[model samples]
Target: MSPLFPDLALPVPPDRPALRFGDRSLTYADLAAAAGALAPRLRDAGRVAVWATPTLETAVGVVAALLAGVPAVPLNPKSGDSELGHIVRDSAPTLILTAPGTELPAALGDLARLDVEDVDAAPGRGAPYAVEDVPDTAPALVVYTSGTTGPPKGAVIPRRAVATTLDALADAWQWTGDDVLVHALPLFHVHGLILGILGPMRRGGSVRHLGRFATEGVARELNAGATMLFGVPTMYHRIAEALPTDPDLAKALAGARLLVSGSAALPVHDHERIAAATGRRVIERYGMTETLMNTSVRADGEPRAGTVGVPLPGVELRLVEDDGTPLTAYDGESVGEIQVRGPNLFTEYLNRPDATAAAFTADGWFRTGDMAVRDPDGYVRIVGRKATDLIKSGGYKIGAGEIENALLEHPAVKEAAVTGAPDPDLGERVVAWIVPADPGARPTPDELAAHVAARLAPHKRPRTVHYLGSLPRNDMGKIMKRALKTDD
Candidate 1:
């Protein structure tokens, strides 16, 4: 009913820092004035595109669009020509917003460019906002999903969804205005943009972007009054590697109130190592492009190392089978596909009514396609994606996440990803693509299999092991499992 950022429009202290990126920082007053300057221009535009470059311009541009009651599309700077072209053409944005020095790719050449820096960002500079016009159901952003299967689809996120999810997380994480979030994630996706940037703003909290991910940057911000840390598995893995020799890094991490990891599973080994050094356990949360956030390990709840924990406030979650029937049990072993229904869901896949229609069930629950087992205590442990992570091996339904975690526990393995491959007798067999800890002294397949078998059941052990210098990962450090599948 009200503007997403009600506090931003109100008067604030001149010295209160709202955002910081590297050396550049903006006070809450600075952001409000700048966004208000561009709000009038965006109010009448069909939809504006933002070159999400982890800069002040990108943040101000998106916030301006939100204030203007216009939809903003965040284009990934790292997208290739084809991906960029597809998005630009699909979203059909009226204009593209970027920083002064940004050299946009050829794909964006056709769109009119609005250089945000050139605009006046002086304190108390812009006209008054008409906040009463924007409705709760209006689209706030059109975020494109990772086009793993085909051309990326735009998920039309409503203002209400963003407001609901953020408020829910505030309750779950005990997040407050006093907290300062430190992260180096790209602003293209939900994790980095909506939750990482807009999330803090919604709480009237401050955020410090690391320009790019570095363990030193994380340590520096955390040591300098940052209460919470948000990162992907890759960043945490690096922190885990650096913790033994870096006392300052460990001390800074230990002093932080919360450390959250998502976008992909953080291996149990990394969790243990970080916990061992910092005396802090990294909590995990689960979410998707379609659903802003489904579940999270609560701040006051048990911080289970491998599980993503229970559903957030106002979110209704369930585990269903391939038949689309909801599972009745929570045995913590029965693997079922996760389904959720709540206000925190996307309205549709832009211009794809059929695709959007298929994403939800008859009863309106969005099928997540992620397979997981729920503990009796209500925590959800994601095994893997239903399409790739679920392995039917020798009549057993196996979740690759557990097996991958087991493989990571091995001293010889540096990184591990598990996927299912065709087998004549077994239907489908568990296959592991491993990045060995020691390239010269690789662990034998037998040793790895034995190790996994001892921890899990024999059926869950990898039927085949493939070694590589590194696993293929996307921008968010999520392993490209489909890429691995295609490799075979």
Candidate 2:
């Protein structure tokens, strides 16, 4: 088994920066030495709760966890006290690590606390404790759900599974030691843990954290020099909107070897607009918390506008109807639920055996809970979530993405979300919530209906549309259709 941390750190020049947070830069040697120094402190704790949002602390905590054999649970620092208390109770962490001002949840206030700013707090009692190295199959990290559907469920990820995901990303994206990854996503989600950090670190590449997002800061980083960039659709959209006409920003973004978008479905128009703004297509991939990313758009070939490309080398994908029978072929046009079986699939929901059992097929394929269809060319386009997002009306199915895509085509529309709202006559009615570009340039309901009718079938067009300042989105940029439905 390969040691999670390379013994000698990355082979980059000692003075060369491997991590950057605004003006701060840490060389490869510094990170390695810091990780080594922090290792014993973590080892003493046995279990650590890192309540820091995506930052250098996350990267350091993760690296320290691997080195010390302590299991790390990363929580959203901004989570409310009640939610934080629930997480603390569920995970039962031995020690809490946080920045000076982090509010402690009532339940965890009495636990031993380690101040993050004082990295040297752990004394140098240098005798290394013998630890049974965690096998690849042993649990490494526990990530909780976003609590969109209900209370967050902790999902335990095995070390092997994490490594498998990293390996798959490396193989598919051709990441190497020479690549530098600049990440602007939250570490609480799988996107940051596996895609943003592990994928690059496993390949011996240097990974940099943005701490907090500012388009100008990102532009400055790109201008300063970064080979790769990864972010969600929201981050990209913000950056695209803020610096629309800056040629220098455009050039810096276009110069990256690769730019990736995932964690949520990127609307087709948003995807295209970003590509036009920056000369490279933002490669969209498909993944969920249960399965770390398993598919991606090709680096060299034509990236289709509405589809995420084929499965990675070691991943197996199967589409099934509601009855759970696999579809015959990838015709790309037939929509069905996407089922995945891969080396990277998570072990189970922490302490929830029944839910875990129900999540998998009898034969072991994970029930992704996401519906998608494949084209004749084998490209995959995700329909909305099965239970909440997809709308059905008069025996016809409608996808949020499809209507959102159409609405985005209108110059006045900034963002849109479509959902099946309740109705007495139709089984369900298509409802749209939109953000308009011009305050007074809102489309009338008839105009909006006619706008979608021109491009879509009668059943597919939204019957009701509402103009809003913004659509409610989660941290990862996925529209909360359920919340919208609840609001009505």
Candidate 3:
């Protein structure tokens, strides 16, 4: 009902910075002026494309589109030609907004392009457009999901979803305008763009983008008054490895009000390492493209190492069996597919009626393909994806994440991914793809299996082990278990 960002409309000090990327920065006045100048150009457009780079221009472009009540489709700058072409053809945006001199790939050749900096150069152009009052149900963003199985589907996120999600996170994280957020995540994804950037804007806070994620960059910003840090597992892994040798990095992390990790599961090993060195526990949360944010470890609550805390405000979560029957008790052993209904849920998968229908139950809950278990206190621990992580072996269902965590505890196991492979007697066998901690002194398959059996139940132990130099991963540092070979 209210404006998504109330602070942007009200005049603040002309010198107070609202957003920063590397050395470049924009004050609230500068942002208001730039966005005001750009909104009019996009006023009549049905939909526009943003070359979502981790730059100030991309931020300004998206904000301007929102201000004008036009749906913005954020195109990932790193996507391949075919992927980019599919998105362009599917979305069919009227104009492409990009930074000055950005050399777009051949896929965007047919689209009209406008440099975002043009508005900044000619501030107060075309009589200062007033911000439109967009309805809560109006489509604000068309974010594409990672098309692992097929071409990416655009998730049509409404303005209310954004407003409600951020406000809920504000309550969960104790977020306020005084808190400065910092991250270097790619801007196209919901975690980076919606939460990392817009979350700060909604709270009337500032965000410092590092241009790229580096421990030095994070330390530098945090040391200079940044209050919170958001990162993926890879970034935190590096920080955990560096903290032993880097006091400045440790101190910087220790000084922060909160350290949050998302987009994938952060290993318990890395979590313990960071906490041991910095006396700060990294919080983990779970959500997907279709759901902006479902659950998070609260700032005011216990900083549990592995669980993703409780369901966020306005989110109703339930775990269901394979037959779609809801589980009642949360004794921590029963695992089920997570289905959620909330204001955070996306309206639909754009143009895919069948997919939109299939994604939700007849009753309105969005079926998240993620499988997880709940603690007695409602903390959700994601085991893995339903297709890959849930293994039925010898009549016992096992979650790959717990086994992977167990393998990671071994001194000789540097990295691990678990999956179910076809077996003759057992319906499926637990298989571990491991990277040895010491190349010359690699742990044997038997030793690794026993290590897991000791920590977890023997039924959940890896039936087979394969050693690899490293596990294949996506840009988000999530292990691509589907890509791993199971032939041997």
Candidate 4:
């Protein structure tokens, strides 16, 4: 493939903005001068850890590492000591790059540090980078993703995977250099770093990062010529809540070219509310860390609420039975495990060959462990993870995502999550965890059961209901159902 970023190497308009974090911003020339100067410092350094704090330095550090043909591991700033320690030891980087004033956790205190501010961004300070030095098979990043056992596994992502995923998304989203994207997502994970930041740079476009998410900040940027907005379901939910009181937010949202949501299934209720107020439907996409991006609702196609559109270009996707046979009939009801094979797939789990080997089939398709069903028109609607989402109660298999979406439609329900728990008669019964819109007049369990039963079938209704002040969520705003199930 061509260079990861063609424009970064050659000279561009010095005044053209490339990255902005709050009050600090970097133009195209400034980015190249800084990343290019620091690229040589990372040339001999083995895998390096970037103290990812959603700042300009973190972005420049990762880019310099990529330019130097070395694997960069992004460390989450909010990680606890135990979780942080595990990643540092597992990745074993020789260097850690941080912003000038940021103090790293004790887990990374031992690594040799290179503060980006200390580096001189003088033009022609270092030898220019050769794209051929990094081949398609060369490992570009070792991104850590959560797992059940031990700690989060570092997925070794190759240059080809990054190149192809971005190219495919460009075709899918009609993304171009003219598009200016805005988001406030953290810099640690794929959703933020890869898609949110790097995707813009690769397209030779500019990105404006909200130091943190707020409806007012989103409106300010979107109203100021930003065409696209990327966010998770929680951010979108907040937008839906503020739409009535904030007409400026609604006007800004309606004026944008695209508003995309991911990392979880956005409840259909939020989707409807946003569209009703803005007259613009927020699109949903499906992907995982190991697989950079699998599918997205096409920019020109119908913006269906729940479905994450079709498989992205160059990605081969299929729903498989437990016996490993691909499901043929797409009747919009048959549920199966999702298996995908593509150049976009990560190389392996860092230092775990056994887990890597088990993740794939004999034929080479990677088992996603995500349960989903395909509509007759080929839209894929993910129900939930196979481990936590599928509920086989009373001899029928049901998807928690669908039931949760239904519950959110209730006037009293503010937030909802559905899970399967052990039952006496039914092998596993559906349980609902709800955050009511009104605490004083919360919907009764029987009322909720009846409401769900009337909308869906009787078997799909929750067997029990529990009210909560709010649901526990991860940094990406995904509901932690595992925490809910174990009461952790």
Candidate 5:
């Protein structure tokens, strides 16, 4: 399959920057040539491991590997030596792609290494790659999940899945050549790599890539006139908080073609507040590492507050009860596990056939491990993570998201995380981890309990509320619910 970069690279405006990282900018011709030169090196090396932080280097590595027909694996740069060694031993990558001075194990000392600076060196005006005939089902990339529930498993995302996702997004979101995207999400995550990078780039739009999430830096990009913005919910919250005094920041953000929030659920109030402050409502979407992204709310329509709008053009979703019976979307607020059937879904876990088999239904749908409800209009409201987040008290099951959403409404609460705590009589009780809005004026546990009591059902209310200095998060800013659960 031909890479999406070749045709996009051609006829691009010569003077304009096609990729931006900090003060450095690469024109379309520069990036294409850079990718063209690195392709052969990657081919000679075989499977490549990319650990570059979210920067132009990561983007360059991805495009070059695809062009060279090399299956690329992207890792968190902060992964320790032991973890990195595990990946190295398991995948046995032909080359490691990362920053120049990053430390490597003795096993990889003699192995080939390609740094972003090396790739940025004079473009090797070598033979343009003879497009390798890779099958649509062949693995294109391997990305490990958050590894919260268990050991990290490599998810094999095929070329067809990537292409299908990009094609669907372009059609659903109406991505065009005229759009300019200011992207702040990490490149290693599916949301960042596929939706933030490939989705826009494949459609002929330019990307202003940030090395990391910097609210002020992103604000500058918006001020510089980016047409689109993509980030996680936490990033948006911080951005909103940073602009409390500068009203212009909100105005600049409102002018974007679209603003996307994903990777974690965003509160309805946060969505409304962001929209009211900035001119555009943030389009909340739903997806995971297994599937790139299959649902989204449109920029033009009413983005129903809590719902992640309908499934994309080529995707189909079904709700199934615990007993494997299909549930009607209109069964009076009945919620079930979301099983997805889509071209965008990943092939399987790299070497975990049993786990892969377990993740899918007896039919073809991939079990998302997430519970959601669909309104009559087909909008999906993700209740919570099925295994780690549901609170079981007495004989009833409660969604932690409901209590957290209610807790967030309090004036003294900045954020909230709810987990099930083991109880004597009930299987588990609701436990809330709260981040205060005011350091000194934070509410007491009794006060917070009263606050949630007012909004949630008697059984759904949190039995204990613990004030936390800060929530533990991954590189992508998603609260580590698995870690928080074990903390207590």
Candidate 6:
């Protein structure tokens, strides 16, 4: 019923910057004009493809698509030809929008193209375009999943989902026009495009994109004027490692109002290291592409490490057993699958009714494959994905995330991932894949196993330890356990 972004229509100072990428910046008026100019061209299109590059044009393309009431499908720039082909064939966008100098791969060459830079130039200088009133059920974005099991499925997100999620986050994070957000995340996913770009715009705030993630760049922006910093664990790990020697980096972090980490769990060791150095706790939130945002550690609440805080306003969350029964009485030890129902939920998977039907329960709760435990105080700590992270070993249902965190506590371990392997005696055995801190002085497998036993229960300790130079990770810094080779 109401517009997603009300502030864009209101009269704000034309000089107030709405977005900044490296040296280039766009004011609210400039962004409005740029998006307005391109919206008219896309008004009749049903769906469009956006070449999601880490640039100012990507933001403009998405905004223009939203203004035009068209669903935008973000194409990952690094995706392979096969994956790109699958997306193009699936979504069937009318045209592909990209920057002027971008060289598209052959997978996208056949589609009609429109350079956002051209429309961004002098198209809307004559008259301001009126903001259109889009129906709440209209699809705003068609974001694809990570495709862990099969080919990626397009999740059709509606305008109401985007608006409600942003509004809930604003209430939880105390976000406003005064807060300037800074990040270098890719615009293809929900964490980057919806939250990083649209979140600030909804609040009438500003965003400063780093173009690429670097500790020096993050420090420069925060020290200059940016009040918030959003990053994944890898970026924060480098920052934690660098803060010991770089006083400027520590000073920059100390001046930041909020430092949020998502996409994966931030190891408690890194969390403590950063907090000890800068006196700021890095807040972690949990969500997925199918669901915009389910939970976040409130800015005004306790900044607890290793736990994603309570559910946000208007979201109903519950932990359920495998039999579809809800688990009541959270004793901080029982792990269950997280099921959620809220306005932030996506409408459906594009062209796949079967998958969409299987994702939700008969009562309408969307079943998230993530497993988590709830504390007595209502904090939700994600254990891991149900497919890989939940290991039933020695008659105990143990979470790999807790074991991984314990392994990271050891001084000899630099990076770690935990999984389960088949065993004749035990149904499954806990196995730890580790990257040693030193190549020459690698800790013995027995010693590392004993270290985990000392920290956690004996049953939770790793039965076997495998050493590697590095762990395979996706772009989001999450360990790819499926790619790991665990040998007997």
**How much does candidate 2 score in TM-score?**
0.92
Runs of candidate 3 with Cα error greater than 4 angstroms are 118-129
* TM-score to native of every candidate shown: 0.98, 0.92, 0.98, 0.97, 0.93, 0.98
Question: Weakest 10 consecutive residues, lDDT, candidate 4?
Answer: 118-127
Poorest 10 consecutive residues by lDDT, candidate 2: 120-129
Give a tens-digit lDDT track for model 3, residues 290-345: 99999999999999988899999999999999999999989888999999998899
Question: What is the alpha-carbon lDDT of model 6 when measured against the actual structure?
Answer: 0.91
Model 6 reaches what TM-score against the true structure? 0.98
Inter-residue clash pairs, candidate 4: none
lDDT of 1: 0.91
Q: What shift in Å separates residue 436 of candidate 6 from its native position after superposition?
A: 0.4
- Report residue 183 deviation for candidate 6 (angstroms): 0.4
lDDT for every model? 0.91, 0.75, 0.91, 0.90, 0.78, 0.91
Q: How close is candidate 1 to the true structure, as a TM-score?
A: 0.98
Which residue pairs in model 6 clash with each other?
A: none
Model 6 segments beyond 4 Å from truth? Answer: 118-127
- For residue 363, model 6's alpha carbon misses the true position, in angstroms, by 0.5
Which one wins by TM-score: 1 or 5?
Answer: 1
lDDT of 3 at 127: 35
lDDT of 2 by residue, 1-488 (tens): 56665523435455645555545555556656655576678876766888756655556667677777777788886687777787777888888767567666665667777755533233232333333376877767888888776778888877777777777777767777788888777777788776777666667667778777767667766777678888888888876775477777788788888888888877778777778887677788888877877788877656777677888767899889779989987775566888999888888887789889999999999998888888776678988888876677887667777878888888888888888888788889998888888869887778778888898777778878877887887777777776675455
RMSD of each: 1.3, 2.8, 1.4, 1.7, 2.4, 1.1
Clashing pairs in 1: none
Task: Give candidate 3's error at residue 46 in angstroms.
Answer: 1.0
Those runs of model 1 whose alpha carbons end farther than 4 Å from true positions after fitting are 118-128, 485-488
Which 10-residue window in model 6 sums to the lowest lDDT? Answer: 119-128
For residues 1-488, could you state the per-residue lDDT of candidate 5 as single tens digits? 65665544355555555778777677666777777777767776667988757777788888888877788888776776666666666677887787667775564446578785655553744445555677778778888887777678888998888888888777767888778888777777788787777776677767888777777667778888788888888888887776667676776786677888888888766876777777677888888889888788866557776778888879998888888788875542676888999888999987889999999988899998888778787788888888976666897767777777888888899989998989998889889898998889888887877888888766777777787899988777778887674445
